[model samples]
Target: MKIVKVEEFDLRREVEYGSAEQNEAVRTIVSDVKKEGDAALLRYTEKFDGVCLEPAGLRVTQEELQAAYSQVEPSFVEAISAAAANIRAFHLRQKRNSWMDLQPDGSLLGQIIRPLKRVGVYVPGGKAAYPSSVLMNVIPAQVAGVPEIVMVTPPATGGKAGIDPYILVAAAEAGVHEIYRVGGAQAVAALAYGTDTIEPVDKICGPGNIYVALAKREVYGVVDIDSIAGPSEIAVLADDSADPAYVAADLLSQAEHDEMASAILVTPSEAFAKACQAEVERQLAELPRRDIARASIRDYGAVILVDSVEAGIGVINKLAPEHFELIVEEPMAYLGLIENAGAIFLGPYSSEPVGDYFAGPNHIIPTNGTARFSSPVDVDDFIKKSSLIYYSKEALLQNGATIVELARREGLEGHARAIEIRLLKEGKAGTNNDNQ
Candidate 1:
């Protein structure tokens, strides 16, 4: 890991930055899926996943999910069920209610909050499996009262179309309406456009490979997306009290995700920064993904020795990290200073993975530097709001002239005439059009 004073300005961008090949590949997949629909999905599955699945077999069945529960250990199933309960408990607090306000003039204005008709959650399954992702993606939508929730994951090798038992169990526990054994760009396209097998969704959520991210970008107009997520990243703002080993281990946790992932430390203590660097080196030797972590740290990781804790907070807000960990002696003191993190973890006990799984917060957080504007996935993603208005003759008569004048000022004669015509037809205003 590189240790540099905060003044250094030559840090390389994270490795997960998109490349031409990734973009091109995503474009090709999206085009093929757009043109061919289910057939294209089958072809891609065979070409990329090495599995040939019929359209009917693409949708997972209740029997399959039940079998998955049987395949998984009782203890694992129980654990996923418990996690789902916690996730549901947390997101239930985010549910919104429709509200309306009536005015003295007999006009009513309000917003109607309703759950999406359907939603699709994409869970990555090939070499790596994330059962926790199933919980994070589905539970929130369920809490939002979405009528239908579907999930998709790539089939494993040997032409298996079954989800990981843990993932299936989690989905069942989270109340997912359906599951599909399709993944990658094709899965995203399937959800966006509605193929013979997969139904179109109002919104798509979850994280995937670079191809999935690009596919989401392509289909954004057809269906809503959470955000264009990038590689995972974590920025630790610490003081002298933070343990070097804990800091090093937490940084490596994100670094091991991919070579493009970033792990940064900003602190006022130069000696603490140096100790973290040494501890990272010692810990990297024992990790199974040491080579990937080492490359990530060498390329994108840094220890920034700032002048003060206040200055460290400034650097963190400028960076806008996806995951911000406060490992200081008095972590709560700086909580109000943080304004740009997707998820903030305070103190040594609240590690990133805790939020990723057992913790109730959604794990599908904004990545890169998008935390400056984007937010973590939550119940709000699966709901829509509609503005509603009601007006009585009395209300329209009272505001009619003002509305007409404003519309006429904007050169919209038709809009002005509509209001005037209504008033005149009701005999509430004169055809001569005099203000008196």
Candidate 2:
């Protein structure tokens, strides 16, 4: 890790739109799935995942969901159940009801909120299988009252059939019964446009590799996606009071995710910055994914020097990090200064992994600088809102002339006539038809 002045450090990477070859491949796969349906879906599954399967074996049976419980230990089930309860309880608070306001003229205006009819959650298999993510994606949609929730993962992970046992158990625990044995671009296409074995969903959620991200981008307009996630990142805003070892460990937690992941520290104390830099080097060697973490630290990790902790907050706002940690002596005092962060962890005990696993908040957050605009996934992601208006005769008669005047000023005669015709039918039109 390098130490530099705050002005000298620049860690932002260009947005990944994928290469032409990858984009072309995703386009071809999506087109094939749209045209050939299940046959194309199965072919790609075999080619990409090296798993061959018949059409009859596409969907995971209820027996498999039940059997998955036996493959995992009792402790695993108990832990996940507890985590699920916490996640459910947290998201339930975000649930909203439809509301209406009656006007004095007998008109009604309201917003109707409803969950998407169906949702598809894509859980990665192989080396990146995370049961924690299964709960993060599924529980929020369930809280939003989505009727049909389906899950799609690769057929085999580490050369084992029926996917990973932990993933199956997580899905079953999350109350998702519709599991499919397909993955990659083909699976994303199948979720967007229904195949013989699978049904189309209104939205898709969860994380995957670059190929899956490109696939999600391809099918975005046809079906909504959670977000095209980038590599994991962490930014620690700490002071001399913070322990260097804990800071270094927390930074490496995100760095191990991939070589592109970034780990950064911002502080006023140059001595504290140097201490953390040394601690990061010491800890990097012990990580099982040290090779990946080492590259991440060497390429993207840094300790930025600031005039004061207040100055550090300004730099962090510009960076708009995905995960932010405030390890200062008085963390709460600086909370209001933070304006851009996907998830804010205050104090030493609130580590990033806590939210990733047992914590109630959704771990699927905006990455890169996207935290400036977007947010972490919550109950709102799975629901849609429609504006409702019931205009009574009195209300329309009173406002119709003003509406026509505004419409006609914009050179939209059709809009003006729309209000005028109604006013005339209701016997409330003024003597001047144009004004009405």
Number of the top candidate by TM-score?
A: 2
Looking at model 1, report the run of 10 residues with the lowest lDDT sum: 9-18
Cα lDDT of all candidates, in order? 0.86, 0.91
Cα shift from native, residue 424, model 2 (Å): 2.1
lDDT of 1 by residue, 183-280 (tens): 89989998998887787899998889888988999899899998888888999988888899999999999999988889999989989999999999
Clashes of each: 2, 0
lDDT of 2 by residue, 380-402 (tens): 99999999999998899999999
Please list all clashing residue pairs in model 2, or write none if there are none: none
Model 1 has an lDDT value of 0.86
Candidate 2 wrongly placed segments (more than 4 Å): 157-160, 430-436
